[model samples]
Every structure is written in C-alpha cells, then in structure tokens.
Target chain A: MAARSLGVVGARVVVVAAAAALWELVTRLAAQPYFPAPSTIVPRMYELWFSGPVTHVFLTDDALDTFPPSLGRLLVGWVAASLAGIVLGLAIGRSRVLSDFLDPVIDFGRAVPPPMLVPIFFALFRIGTPTQIATIVFGVIWPVLINAVDGAATVDRQHLETAKVFGLSRPQVIGRIIVPSAMPKIVAGLRLSLSLALIMMVISELVGSTSGIGYRLMTAQQNFLITDVWGCIVLLGVLGYLLNSSFLLVENRILGWHSRARQNA
Target chain B: MLEIIDVTHTYGAYQALGGVKLTLAEGELVCVVGPSGCGKSTLLRCVAGLVQPTGGRILLDGVPVSQTPDNLAVVFQDYSRSLFPWMSAAANVALPLRRKGMDRASRRTAAMEALEQVGLAGAAGKYPWEMSGGMQQRVSIARALAYRPSLLLMDEPFGSVDAQTREDLEDLVLRVCAHHGMTIMLVTHDIDESVYLGDRVVVLSRSPGTVAGDLQVSLPSPRDQIATREHETFVRLRAEVGRLIRGNQLSPQET
Candidate 1:
C-alpha cells in the first residue's frame, strides 16, 4: 500500500514537472510579453509575494493587506452559505409542499451566473464589503442547497423505520437520524461551494474593490505590468489549489468512513 | 397480552393481509411462519403499530395501537439496516432508552446489561457495520431487549445469518423471553426455527395472509439445539408446521 501511494505521488510530480518544462520551453521560444516563461513567472511570483519586508511574520504589510481579506471573505461566505443551505434544505427536502413550491424559485436563482449577480449585489448593497460578501454567498449557496436537498430526500428507508421503531419524536428523528445520514452529502456540497466562493470573490473584487489579491491583479493588468500580472495569476492558482487541498484535508477527516467504503469497493 | 383482531391491510387495490386474527398471552413466545410472499411482515407491522390496517384493530395491553406504543419494541429483518450503522453497539442498544426519558448513566447500564444477555458484552463499543451478520442481528436483539418492553415483535430476525448463527440466535431468543417473561411474536419463513423457538406456531397462508393453523408446542424448555431437534415432540411439530406451510392441513390423528 505504501509503495503504491508513493508511486502515485511520484507520478503526479513527474506530470507537473513535465508540464512546467513544456510551458517554459514554449514561452522561451515565443519570447512574447503576453506569455512570460514559467522560470520568469515563478521567481517573480515569489518576489512579489514573499519578497515583502519581514514583519514579525514572513508577510510584509503589502502581503498582509492583500491576501487575508480575500481568504477571509471566502471563509465567511462559504460558512454562511453552508449553514443556511443545510437548514433550509432539510426543511424543504422533508416537506413535499415546501420542496415543490421553492424548487422553481431556487432553479431561477441558481440559473443566474455568479459574476452576473455581482452587479445586482453591488446595486443592492451599494458596492462595498457587504456587496462583495453577498455576491460570494449568493454564488456558493446553490451547490450546498441543492446537494443538501438531494441528500435529505434520499435518506434510507431503513433509517426512518429504525427511527420510528425506536419511537424517536419528529424533532429527534430530524436532528439525530436525518441530519447525520445527510452529512456526507452536505460536506460534498461544501467542497463544491468553496470553489464557487473563490470565483465570486474574484468577480466581486473586479469592480468596486481596492484591497484584495483580485484588486491587485486588476491594477497590474490596467498598468500593463505584464510580469506582475503573471505573478498574480500564479499566486491565485497556488491559493486556489491550497484552499481546495485544505478543504479536502478536513473533508477526509469528517467523511473518513464514506471514502473508506468507496476505496474498499 | 397482545391482540391482532381481524387485521386487514391493503395497498390501493392489492391486499397484503386479509382478516388476520391472533392473540398472545403474557410471557408467551409465538412464532409466525408463512409462505415466501405472504404478509408476515405486514402483520408484524400492524402489531408494532408501524402500519395501520385498513380494516380491524390491534391491541397491546388493552390499548388500541394507532402508533408505536412506548412499551413495545420490534427487531426487524435486514439487521444490517435496522441497527444504526453510525452508532456503537452500546449506543444502538441505548437508543430506545432515550425515549423512555431515562438518565444517561442508567441507560448505559441497562444497554450494557442487554448486550450481556445477547452474549455481545465485549462488543459494546463496536459499530454495527464492523460486526458480522450474526453479531449485527445480536446487536439488533440487544437493542430491543434494552428497551425493556413488555411486548417484543421480531420479523424474520435471524433470516440473514448462517445456519450455525441462526441456531444460536434461536436459543438466545428462547432464553431471553423466558427469563424476562416478555411476550414475543416472532415472524419467520423457517418451519424448523418456528418449532424450535416458539411455545406456539401460527402458520400463515400464501398472499393476503390469514391464519391457516395455530398449533401448540409441548417440547420442554432449557432446550439444547441437538437434543431439541432430536426430541420426538420437536420432530413431530416441525413436520406438522412444515405441512401446514406447504398448504396441507395436519393428518386427523396428528391434529
């Protein structure tokens, strides 16, 4: 098992290294301003991010000012959407009347693209922190909500029967049995919603935003700082990958049984 | 005492049970045997008050059952599903105790005692999914026993396990019921199991199940698997129950 997993990690590293080498080769041959080679972009990204003057921490005031707000907004938006989606989804999923009545409205809301909704949020909340946060929350809510509904709706019949046979009350049944059974699905929804949250965070920052990584990227693009633009792109890619991997870390902890079953199968 | 009076359950136009009547004296163990597609489960559901009969009523200790009564518990087939997979064996057993408004310590003690009775005392901390089919069904039985219900309904509880485990569970049921003086109505499709475990065997007809025959079991208790099977009384009753289930009445002399 250990050898097999090591082989997998080794294979992944080889693939990533080969892709970077190919990109470096292509960019060097073309020698274009629009496409900085990987070698230039990698060191430039490090200098732009970690090159900040050492505060007590490694981060400079610039890094501190730019990175935290984007990360913080994603966290807050993802958490808020998760909480609301689970509660509302359970209620809607359990009741036929509620599910049917809200299905159309939810469908319409989700049909609107995340970036498109940013302007509406800016108009409603008047273009500030509230607007940016609202846009992220709105974008991420659908995945969590939809998955939660599906999860709660498909709870095993045997579980419900066991609950009834045990004489669990209505609230006890919902709180104990229904919620736990739906939890694996809920966590899956949260993972999808986190990525959507990142997308909305960037779009929200694109307009009427001045203090995030997204703002810095937009500024770099406007000023024709091609190297800085490439640097920001690399940083964002790293950030997105880190966010997803960290979420997986937590997801694996919580859904260990679920994944273990899948692996065994 | 439990009374299932002329219970008839229908789903749309298809009848699952038609006018089934049965009764159990307090502390009696009655095994219900029926054909493969018969309404043994439907009848058990009616007795447990999990399902309502379209026509007729069920009574447990003189109270008409519209919903599951607080003092009653059921062990269903598909033990893998009935026992909550997420909960430990002890916690699963303690589940019914939560409904009775018992304190946590008392619930835990009682649940442990139930597990002890089913010979699964060491497995208290294990989850249902971690156990084999036999052990899981034992956990399901432990859950019901922990409830301390006066009346217990078991629906094909041992059907999923292997031959050896089935015999062990059969003996466990007899001991548990006799010791606690708990009234039990066990439903199964196994004729030999019905004879071995029951003080009375109630045979059910094919579909739209109604009582075909109810015979008394006179074999002595403190029963051993080998000795019990070899006993003249056990052999006679098993054959008689077998014939009844196969749609033949007992010979006049046997009846």
Candidate 2:
C-alpha cells in the first residue's frame, strides 16, 4: 500500500513538473510582456505570498485584504449552503409527499445556470461583499441537496425492516440506519459542491469584489502584471486541490470498513 | 405463549391468508412448512406485525399485535439484506438495542456475547460483505439473539445457504432455542427441515392459505443430525410431512 501510494504521488509530481516546464518553455520562446516564464513568476509568487511588501499593501486596507476576506466568505457561504442543503435533502428524501411537492422546484432551480444568477444577485443585493457570498451560496447548494436526497431516499429496504424489527423509533431509525447508509453518496455530492463553491466564489469576486484573488487577477490584467495573475491562478488551483484532498481524507476515515473490504478483494 | 387466531390478510383485491389459526406454547419450536406462494410468510408477518391481519387478531400474552411487539425479532432469508452492509457484524447485532437506552459499550458487549453464542465471535469486526453467505446468516441470527426476544420469527432463514450450512444452522438453532427457552416460529419449504427442527410442524394449503395439518414431532431432544436422520421416527415424520405438503391425505396415526 505504501509503495502504491508513493507511486501515485510520484506520478502527480511528474505531471505537475512537466506542465510547469512546458509553460516556462512556451513563455521563454514567445518572450512577450503578456506571457511570463515560471522562473520570473515563481520568485514573485514566493515574495508576494511570504516575504514581501505585497502583504503590507494588501493587508492594511479592509477593501484590499484579498486572502483573508475571500477565504472567510468562502468558508461561511459554503458551510451555510451545506447545512441547509443536507437538512432539506434528508427531509424531502424520506417522505413521498415532500419529494413529490419539491421535485419540480428543485429541478427548475438546478436547471438554471449558476453563473447566470450573478447579475440577479448583484441587482438584488446591490454588489456588496454579502451579495458576492450569497451568489456563491446560491450557486453551490443544489448539487449537495439533490445528491443528499438521492442518497437518503435510496436506503436499503432490508436495513429499514431490520431497524423496524429491532423496535427503533422513526427518529432512531433515521439517525442510526439511514444517515450512515447514505454517507458515500452524500460525500460525493459534497465533493461536487466544494468545487462549484470555489468557482462561484471566484466568479462573484471577479464581477464585483474590491478584494479577493479574483479581483487581484482582474487588476493584474489591467496593469499587464501577467506574473501576478498567473500567481493568483496557481493559488486558486492549490486551494481547490487542498479542499478536495481534505474532504477525501475525512471520507476515507469514516468509510474505512467499506474501502478496506474492497481492497482485500 | 403466542396465538394467531383466525387471522386473514388481503393485498388490494387478492386475498393472501384466509382465517389462518395457529398456537405456540412457551419454549416450543414450531415450524410452518408449505408449498411456494402458500401465505406461510403472510402468517409470520402478521404475527410479527410487519403486516396487519385484515380480519382476525394476533395476540401475545393476550395483548393484540398491532405493531412490532417489544419482545420479538425476525430473521429473514436474505441475509445480505437483513444485515446492514455499512455496519460491522457486531454493530449490526447491536443495532436493535439502540432504542433500548443502553450505553454504546454495553451494546457492543451484548453484541459480542450473542456472536459468541452463534459461534461467530471471531467475525465480530468484519462487515457483512466480508463474510460468507452462511456467516452472514449467522450474523442475522446473532442480532436476533442479542435482542433476547421472547418470540423469534424466522422466515426461510436458511433458504439461501448451502445444504451443508443449512444442516449446521438448523442444529445450531435447535441448540440455541433449547438453551434459551426461546419460543420460535420458523417458516420453510424444506419438509425434512420442518421435521428435524420443529417440536410441532404446521402445514399450510395453497393461497388464500389455510392450515392443512398440524402434527407433533415425538423425536427425542438434543438431536444429532446424522443419527436423527437414521432414526425410524424421523423417517416416518418426514414422510408424513412430505405427503401432507403434497396434498395427499393420510391417516392420523400415519401423520
């Protein structure tokens, strides 16, 4: 297992290194002001991220505090969306009446393009930070909610009967049997939601925010600071990868018994 | 004591059970044997309160069974379904106790104890998919035993297992019931199994099912599979059950 995982990690490292080398080679060959090589961008990213006056300039003003405000808004909006979606999904999934009543509404909402809602949110909430967060929340919630409902609704009938024979009350049955059985699908839904949430966060910031990586990317484009724009893109990629990996780790811990059996087979 | 007094069940317009009556005394292991689609399952479900009797009443100690009673548990034939896939064997056994207000550690201990009773103690940490078909059924049995139900309802619990595993499980069940003083109602299609495990075997007719015969097994207890199969009384009882199930009427003494 250790060797297999190490090989996987090595393959990822090689792919990332090859991509970076290709980008550097292409930029060096073009030698354009718009396209900067990794050698030029890497030092700049390191300085901006860790050791330079970019932090002072960016951190001093609340409107210029890109990293913290963007991260904070992302966490808050994502958490709210997840909690609401899971609760609503479970309620709808467990009841035929609720599922029938809400199915059309959910289908319609999910059908609407997430990014297209930005203008409506901007117009409604008037382009503030809260509006940006709301846009992310609105865009990311449906996948989680839909998947949660599917997961909860598809609980094995025999397990339900087993719970009944054991004399479990309705609530006890839901908590002890339904939730655990539905977890794998729920985790899959959360993974999709996490990626969508990140994308929505960047889009909302790009459209209106005074601070955030998205705003920084836009400003760097206007100033022709190509390396800084590339730096922000790299940061977003790393952030997204970290979020997904952490979620996978938690999922593995909770579902170790299932995965372990699969491995043995 | 358990009683199914003239119980009848209908699904839409089709009648499943028509006035089925049966009685089981304390510590009695009664097996209900019948042809396929004979509503033997319907009778067990009515007694378990998984389904309601449309006409007559089922009573446990004189109280009518409208819902799953507290001191009863069922072991279903599809072991893969009866045991939760997401849980460990011990956890599945402990599940019925979640509503009984016991602490988690105590539930685990009780579950392990039951698994030990079923000779599956080493498989306590294994998930349902990790175990073989027979072991999975044993896990289901362990779950029921952990609940310590007064009346145990088994609906073709060995139907999915191999013949060898079936014989072993049948003997194990007999031993456990005898030791626990458990009153059991087992429904099966196997004629010999009905004679082997049951103290009394009740045979049911085809759908709109009704009782055809109820014969007492006078075989000695603590039965060994090999020796019991060779016994004259066992041979006679099996033949009698086979004939009754085939709708062939024999004399009372022959049955």
Candidate 3:
C-alpha cells in the first residue's frame, strides 16, 4: 500500500512538472505581458514571500500579513459553518414537520449565488472582516447542511428499528446511530464545502477587505506586477491543496472502515 | 410470558394480519413459520412495540405493550443494517446498555461476556463491515444477548446465510436459549428450522397472516444437524407442520 501511494505521488509530480514546463515554453514564445514564464513566477513567489531578513524565519511582511488573515478567515468561517450545519441538519433531518416547513426557505437560500449575497451582506455588515466572514459562512454552509440532512434522514431502516427495540431514547438514537451512519456523507459534504469556503473567502474579500490573498492579487493586478499576480495565484493553489489534504487526513481516520471496504470491493 | 390476543393489523386499505393470536409461556422458544409476504415480520414488530396492531393488544407479564418494554430486544432481519458499521462489535452490543445506566467499564465487560457467549470473543474489536455476513449476524446476536432481555424476537435472523452457516446458527440459538432459558420468538419460512430450534412451532397463512396451526415438539434436546433431522419425531413433526402451513387451516384437534 505504501509503495503504491509512493508511485502515485511520483506520477502526480511528473504530471505537474510537465504541465509547468509546457506553460513556461508557450508563455516564453508568446512573450505576453499578462502571462509570465514559470521561471519568473517561481523566483517572484520566493521574493514576495521569503525575501525578508535571514533571521526573520523565511517570511516577508506581506506574506505574514496577507496569508495568516486569509487562513484565519477560512478556518473560522468553515468551522462555524460546519458545526452549525451539522447541529441544525440533524434537528431538521430527524423531523418530518420541520424539514417540510423549511424546505422552501432552504431551497431559496441555496439557490441564491454566493456573489449575489455579497452586496446584500455588504449592506448589512459594512465593508470589513464581518462581511468577509459572513459571506463565506453563508456560501459554504449549504452543502454540509443539505448532505447532513440527507445522511441523517436516510439511516438504514433496520438500524432505527433496532434502536427502538433496544430502548434507546430519542436523543441517544440521534447521537449514536443516526449521526455516525450519516458521518461518511457529512465528511464528503464537508470536503465540498471546504473548497467552497476557500472560493468564498477570496470572493468575500475581493470587494471589501483591506487584507487577504485575494486583495493582494487584485493590488498586484492594478499595479501591473504580472509576476506577483502569477505568484499569488500559485500560492493560493498550494494553500487550497494543503487545506484539502489536511481535511482528508482527518476524514480518512474517521471513515477508515468505509475506505477499506470500498478498496476491497 | 406474553400474549397476543385477537391482534389485527392493516396497511391502509389492505389487511396484512387478521386476528393473529399467540401465547408464549416463560422460557419457551417458539418459531413462527409462514409463506412469503405473510406479515410475519410485522407480527414480530408489533410484539416489540415497534409497530402498533390496529386491533386487540399484546400483553407482556399482564401489561399492555403500547411502547417498547424495557426488558424486550429484537434482532432485525438485515444484519448489515442492524449492526452499526461505524462501531466495533463490542461497542454495537454496548450501545443499548448505555440507556440502562451502566457505566462504560461494566458495559464493556458485559459486551465481552455476551460476545464470548455467541462465540465471537475475538471479533469484539472488529467493525461489522470487517466481518463476513455470518459473523456480522453473530455480532447482532451478541448484541441481543448483551441486552439480557426477558423476551427476544428474531425476524428471519439466519435467512441470508448459507446452509451450513444457517444450521450452525440454529444450533447456536438453541444452545444459548437453553443455557439462559431466554424466551425467544424466531420468525422463519424454513420448515425444518422451525422444528429444530423451537419447542413449539406456529404456522401462519399467506397475505393476511394469522395462526393456522401450533405443534409441540417432543424431540430430545442436544439435537444434531444430522441425527436430530433423521430422527423419527423430527421428521414427523416437520411433515405435519409443513402440511398445516400449506393447508392454510387452523386444525388444533388434528395436532
């Protein structure tokens, strides 16, 4: 298994390198102002992020300021949305009445685009961190909420009967059988929501925020710093990839049985 | 002891069960046999108080069973769904014990003991999905055993297993029931199994399931799959019960 995963990682590295080499060649030939070669972007990324004093731990002031706030906003918003989504999802999923009554409302909220809500939220909370956080929270909560509801609602029928026959109380049933059964799907939903949270984080800051990776990208664009813009894009991609891998580490541990079962099958 | 008196159940306009009456004495192992779509599962659910019969009542120890009684447990037909896949086998058994206010340590001890009883002590730490169909079913049985209920209801518990595994499970049930003197109502469509495991066999008709016949088995205990099946009493009882079930007639005088 370890050898197989190693091979997979090796192949992925080759693919990425090949793509970068092709991009560098095409852009050098074209010599476009908007499109910098991979070589330019790599050194510029290093200069922008780690061009500070050697004693300063390989991070510049811009890196320290922009990266942390973006990360902080993403984490806080995602965590809050996840918890609230699961709790509310479980409650709504378990009851036929509440789910029915709230169906139309949930549909409406999910239907509205995240960018469309940006203006509405800007009016409510002003152009600041609050608006940024709210936008992300609003955008990412739906996938987790809807999937959690589906997962909780569709727990195997026999398991519910077994719970009843065993004399487990309503709360006990929900906590033990319902939630655990729903966990795999909930984790899947969480993964989708995580990516959405990253996207929403950038979109939220695009119009209002003073600091963030997105704002930095916008600033670089306005200043015609083409290499910095490419560098920031690469940085965002790496950050997104790292965040997703971290979530997977936890997910694999939680749903280890499910993955093993699928592999054997 | 439990009593199902004049129990009638309907699903919308369709009558699934009509006047199904049964009386189970203390420490009795009864097998309920019937054809397909006979509502045998519904009867077990009604007994467990998981479903309400449209008419009459189920009385456990002279008390009407409107809700699931504290001392009753059921092993559902689908072991894959009944056992929580996320939990270890022992944890699955221990989950029901949580409501009884047992602490974690005691519940673990009891779960281990119950798993030991079901010959699945080594499987305690394994998840249900990690095990085979038969092993998963054993875990479900262990869970029911761990509950230490006064009455146990098994709804087609061994229907999904192979023939050899089915016989092994049947003997396991017999051994466990004899050892604990636990009252059991096992639902099955297999004829030989009904006589093999049950002290008494109750036959039901198709569709609107109701008591068609009840036969007492005088066959000796410590029954072997081969020897007991070949025994004269086992053969005679099986044949009689088979005829009665096929006939769809309640003839107590004939038995």
* Candidate that scores best on TM-score: 3
Q: Residue A9's C-alpha lDDT in candidate 1?
A: 92
Please write out the lDDT profile of model 1 over residues B82-196, one tens digit for every residue.
8766678998898778878999999999999999999999999987767889999999898888888899999999888899999899889988888899999999999988888
| Candidate 2 residue lDDT tens string, B1-255 | 898889888999988898999889999999999987789998988888888789998999888999889999999999987787778899889988877788999999999999999999899989998989999999999999989999999999999999999998999899899889999999998988999999999999877788989999999888889999889999998998888878633345853
Ranking by TM-score: 3, 1, 2
Q: How does each model score on lDDT?
A: 0.86, 0.87, 0.90
Worst lDDT 10-window in candidate 1 chain A: A256-265
- DockQ scores for all predicted structures: 0.50, 0.56, 0.71
TM-score of candidate 3 on Cα atoms, chains taken together: 0.97
Clashes per candidate (backbone, < 3 Å): 0, 0, 0
Q: Each model's TM-score?
A: 0.95, 0.92, 0.97
Ranking by DockQ: 3, 2, 1
The alpha-carbon lDDT assigned to residue A128 of candidate 1 equals 69
Error of 3 at B204 (Å): 0.9
Model 2: residue B240 alpha-carbon error in angstroms? 1.9
